[model samples]
Target: MSVWLPTAPCTPRDCAGHLGARRAPLPAAVLLTAGCALTLLGVACVPAVLLLGPAHRDRLIRGWAYAVVRAFGVRVRVTGVTAGEGRSPVGELVVANHVSWLDIPLVATVLPARMLAKSEIRTWPLLGPLAALGGTLFIERDRLRALPGAVRALAGALASGSRVAVFPQGSTWCGRSGGGRFRHAAFQAAVDAGAVVRPVRIRYLTAELHPAGAAAFVGEDPLAASLWRVVTAAGLTAEIRVLPPIPAGSEPDRRALARAAQSAVASDSANRPAESVHH
Candidate 1:
């Protein structure tokens, strides 16, 4: 769970105002704890979901994901479809910008894909086991030597007609001043598997649908503190936009694919409409 924490300083005025807003204004512990408990319950159901077969597993997992977001007091609004509705593009590799931990359930609900995660996520409390069981492919990021194997594993999953998701930025950031550079590793997986590279953008908003500073998990903010910030918000909303898929033919190499996907996400995030949907 030790992701990169940018040492970027907070604006003095922004800090003073945000500090006043930091007071835990609601029963955050109760809500967040309940969310965690329910998510674990979903994890417990995974074995059974698998038994029901892959198609059933996806629907059940999606239902479970939707419930988790409710418990967190966040609403979700989605635009477009992952590879378009009803069209299951084989080897669908979904790539999205990194934001908060909340991004997982938010996006997973839309596309029932296995996540490609850092090995550190396996160390998280209750959520870790759930993620692992939910079909996350853990990469020992510290070991550069393991990249090829990890990429091949991802390719294998994609080749099997299972969708996979990754945060190509490789780290989270405060999206207000723009996002971090997208790394090319995940795109290589797309290339290796000949998968459809789907770019997604995740935005956190307040009840009024404005950007939520409290929701961004930037810097060295502890997980507990981040959870508290989310729980205390009167209400938060996460928007997931599934842009058009980029196939191998569109880009000559991994670098081209990665750069194209990154630009798509950045452009979409910037030009996205202000309208918000509640559900």
Candidate 2:
């Protein structure tokens, strides 16, 4: 199958259409095989590092997963992760806005973090296995009685020296429109655990280059096609900004803390001009 390469000297705006028109169907067999191979590689490494235990093992799995995604053609660019005052010795909670499924590997690549994911992901075919290996904590929103235990588990992970990554927005968006309203539960979790909340902003630079909502895996947009669109498109960039940490003592209430973090991320995202296009 012929792989379409966008022509040289093309503007970001024209690149997507040019590439999409010429896109040959990506081989399902190849994509599946590659994903399986990468996942197995991650699983294999787990037993060897038993001495380092769960925390370090989780980090290793996350690193392998990120490498797999990059090898499969997604390019991730991160900023502000290393900037801030740095995390405390007792671990921290990373609160960020969710944008895409890509955010999983994207955040993993930057931080040795564990995420609070929805329960549905635990049953996804290949992704489910990979996420399980990566130590993702799945939450069943409808199970009210189990929520306290879940929150306690999150606190335990932080106490044990693992950075927990949570999408406070609770849902994804195109970033042009606002993301979903921030959920205060994760912030409360942070406060209850006495962990610092590190806010992050994630933005995908694909709107000007690809179809609106092209990266989303909905309707006609299958996962493989979305992956192809992101990989082959010129000027495709996913920017993540990790802002300063907000100590638990700084905010009087969890809701206020959540709002402050959301505002910080939104403000930072708004200031950045959408002009970084790779030719």
Candidate 3:
């Protein structure tokens, strides 16, 4: 298989079990409707929002992302070291593990950047148009020959002072683990652009703060099913851990850099004092 098309062992039947009793059906219905409405509202506003200045656009995107997650009744808790600390304002490669469709907006809440998404997403209903308008970089995962051009496009974006967010794992995994590991291809873009890597780890939790699996969008899981699971799961919390930034040129090659970033993400750093936190 092509590196861009790596698969994960996680399946919905095995890795995405419900954690507890879900929200009352009535409340869940309200959340579901509200979430969809908020998403469509954002899509409708994308064209107008893009017309604003970069700073204004970013703030709007961040706020919109946070609102979308919140609308689904999933509270976001961000912790760990600050992502942009001591780094250049632009050109940082924000990398994270994939868990659900929710990962896109969740990452945007903290690190709003040009997203790197699979070409398949370009055809996905309202999200497709929204992502395109948001300047997402799409990769043709099935076409190995297209890898060079994709990397070049990503590098060009980063080199042009644009922060880019990429899920280097290529595919979403169970939030707990088993996504095969980060592919080095995206890391090459960072290296080429001389960009710092901001590694982030995301987890879903119950109201009591224990691990929750209902949010994982794994094998054979339809988007509707995943979205329903999120909206109905009362008090589902997405805890985003932004690990320390890996300095530019810190690794000799993409492979080493990929490994370094993955190590930081996979490490058990929960007990370590977080540099900051945001609700």
Candidate 4:
């Protein structure tokens, strides 16, 4: 199997169950409407935002992302970001485990970087144009012949001091039952560009900090269904843990580097709750 198209065993029926106390229907509807409205507003403003200097543009993007998540009624808790880590000038390959559609905005809140998206997202209804306007790098994950070109594109972006956020897991998981392994393909770009690898860990939890499935968007889970689940799930919180970066040349090859990054992600914050700064 092509590492770029790795499969996960997680299914909506089995792993994406509602595990949290749900909000009343009216509140959920309001949250959903607000979230959708904010997302569309961001899309409409993308053109103007792009005209600003990079620093100003990124600040707006970060704020917009946080607002969108809040509109969905999901609290965000982020930890482990050191001083200047989020605003570093050095090019970095920001890799994370995929769990839900929310993962995109969640990551953007802390690291407003160029997203590495599956090419299919380019054709999505509203998100497609927004992603393009936001400078997302689309990769044809199913086409093995496209791997080299994708790698080159990623490397080119990183070599130019651009932070590129990627979900190296290839597919979303429940974030509880050992997620899929981090495929080595994307790590190749970091190695080629001599960029540092920043591994991030994301988890969805209920108010009591128990692992939550309501936010999972795994196999055959429709996007609308996932959104509804998230908005209605009472007191659900997304936890983002930014682990230490692995310097360039720390590993001799991409495989070793991927393994090292994966090890850090899997071991650093598994089930251990750090003091979080909520946004």
Q: TM-scores, in order shown?
A: 0.88, 0.75, 0.94, 0.95
Q: How accurate is candidate 2 locally (lDDT)?
A: 0.63
Write the residue-wise lDDT of candidate 4 on 1-279 in tens digits: 776788888898888877668899999999999999999998999989989987788788888998999999999888887324455556799999899988989998888888999998998766788899899999988899999999999999999999899999899999986588888878899888889999898899999888889999999888888889888899899988888789768999999999998888888764555476876
lDDT of 2 by residue, 62-103 (tens): 567567665544455566644223346766888877656677
Task: Judging by lDDT against the true structure, name the best candidate.
Answer: 4
Candidate number achieving the greatest TM-score relative to the actual structure? 4
- Model 3, 1-279: lDDT tens per residue? 776788888898898888687888899989988888888898899889979987778778888999999999888888876534533665889899889888988988877888999998999876888898889999889999999999999999988988889999888898775456899988998999998899988888887877788899988898888888888887788878877788669999999999999988888454556454757
Deviation from native of the Cα of residue 100 in model 2, angstroms: 1.6
Error of 1 at 175 (Å): 1.9
Off by over 4 Å in 4: 82-86, 270-274
Model 1 poorest ten-residue lDDT run? 12-21
Task: Report how far off residue 184 is in candidate 1 (Å).
Answer: 0.6
Per-candidate Cα lDDT values, in order, are: 0.76, 0.63, 0.84, 0.87
Per-residue lDDT of 13 in model 2 = 36
Better-scoring candidate (lDDT), 1 or 2? 1
Order the candidates by lDDT, highest first. 4, 3, 1, 2
How much is the lDDT of residue 268 in candidate 3? 41
